[model samples]
Target: MSEGFNEASGSIIVRDLIQVIHEQRAYLSEIDGAIGDGDHGINMDKGFTLTARRMEGQLLGMSESLKLLGDILVEEIGGSMGPLYGTFFKKMARVSKGIGVVDGRVLEQMLESAYQGILTIGDARVGDKTMVDTLDPALQALKLANSAGRGFSDALDAMVEGAHAGWQSTKDMIARVGRASRLGERSRGTLDAGATSCYLIIKTLAQSMKELSK
Candidate 1:
């Protein structure tokens, strides 16, 4: 198996992430509409697309690209998603500083840091049906995979699967935080938009790295 992707290839990889967000925008907003303000996809797509445009014609390392993405999300977008996801990516960039390649261990650290960063800014907990649901489970799964001596690809697979499961789990849960929480029992039976978007982000990251591994 390929060891991992070069950190320098982040420019292209980040664009891929933006594309994934763009494609999922409508779906995300639809889910949000069921419980919250219904603008999750639109807001996320706007930020990610704008960031991709700003990074065009530039060459940057993975960490630099991630920081740029985070900055754009925080500065350009409004609403909870902006600050939450912005901080998440920024923390990921922080932990990845000076890395030559993003291997299993490096990716694990990045995810863990990103998760903590979101937690620092947001009070969401496990089963709260927020992005934390997807993030925490994915991070834990990746950590477990790393501990089991899995290769980067295998570990990434574990992370994605865990994230998907976590996202799905939100459908059975009533929101305990955020705007959706106002709905109380009404929030049940629908997926949390934040968790859905978080899963997409993890899946996009894994797919982009897999492309670079080839």
Candidate 2:
């Protein structure tokens, strides 16, 4: 197999992301109900559905598709999630601007860029019961695996594990940001909506890249 996926695979990648979010919409909203507005899934579906429609019949490279998704999320979607995810996707697209094929190393860079991008706007940190709970550890694991000379598949698996662990960690955390923060101890028993969604996003990216690597 090649060391990377073709940059042209972006359309399919984004399409699968839409599918994943759509399928998990109800579950996401349910999780949010524990301490949040219970509309994270609804809003996410709205933005991803729009992105899917816009990508039809267009032959976009990975960066182009990612940029389009970021634009739609930033401009059309409302709430804190809009800007956070928009920055993440946009940063990934920016870092990948000139790449023809996206390799494991490039993917590591993209993930780091996305993580830092979120931190730029969101004040959330590890154990904050936010998406950073998922993203930060995931990036760390990916970086560690890559630095250890792990292959693409191994590094991707490591990231998946890290993200899952981070997502789970949110369940034990006191909500420290957003609406959930108001719930205090009530938020401890449930998974964070943002963290759950973020986990799905990371998992989807890893799965898609794994498939494309073949």
Candidate 3:
């Protein structure tokens, strides 16, 4: 039963997120091509890479790093995802600020804030084949695990599983929001690009937190 990671050293978590987004750029674009403008990956990669460049040689804590990333995304990235994800990270940063140990409770709070922030800016919901599909379930799993007295590491594992399951669930859903909605039933067979990227972000965060807990 590990407690949690040090917020000061957690900048690596953001770095990992940037790396994953860059690595998955092509895949994300391909997924978006099925029902979007096919630029999700490119746009995400550009924003995250720029964040990484700005973060180089900095010794910021997790909250600071998240805020920086969020700011960059909002200010520099294009399209709807920019504002949505920017709000998500910024909200998480607010909850995480000054937390010494990012334990299960703190993580839950951060995730809830991020989730609510997304809801505030976007109309997307669980069945909408959007990032909300993955984010909401992951937040619920973390919250449920923490409430059940699970260890921090276990809670993170639960969050990852929930995110993965939610991402997979998107394949069977018809788009109810975004450009994909125009496809109607045609959107059912493809995975939502936003959901996939959201899953990756959650998965990366969970894994990084698990490692830091050690």
Q: Pick the candidate with the highest lDDT.
A: 3
The C-alpha lDDT values of all candidates are: 0.89, 0.90, 0.93
Q: Write the per-residue lDDT of candidate 2 for residues 96-209, one digit (tens) a residue.
A: 887888877898899889889989898898888999999988999998989998888898999999999999999999999899999898888899999999999999988888
Q: Indicate the TM-score of model 1.
A: 0.97
lDDT tens digits by residue: candidate 1, 108-198: 8998888888888998999999999999889999999999998889989999999999989999998998999998999999999999989
Candidate 3: tens digits of C-alpha lDDT, residues 1-214 = 4799789889999999999999999999999998999999999999999999999888899999999999999999959999999999999898999988899999999999999899989999889999999998898999999999999988899999999999999999999999999999999999999999999999999988988888
Model 2 Cα displacement at 117 (Å)?
1.1
The whole-model C-alpha lDDT of candidate 2 against the native structure comes to 0.90
Clashing pairs in 3: none
**Counted clashes in each candidate structure:** 0, 0, 0
Off by over 4 Å in 2: none
All candidates' TM-scores? 0.97, 0.97, 0.98
Q: Which candidate wins on TM-score?
A: 3
Model 1 ranges with Cα > 4 A deviation: none
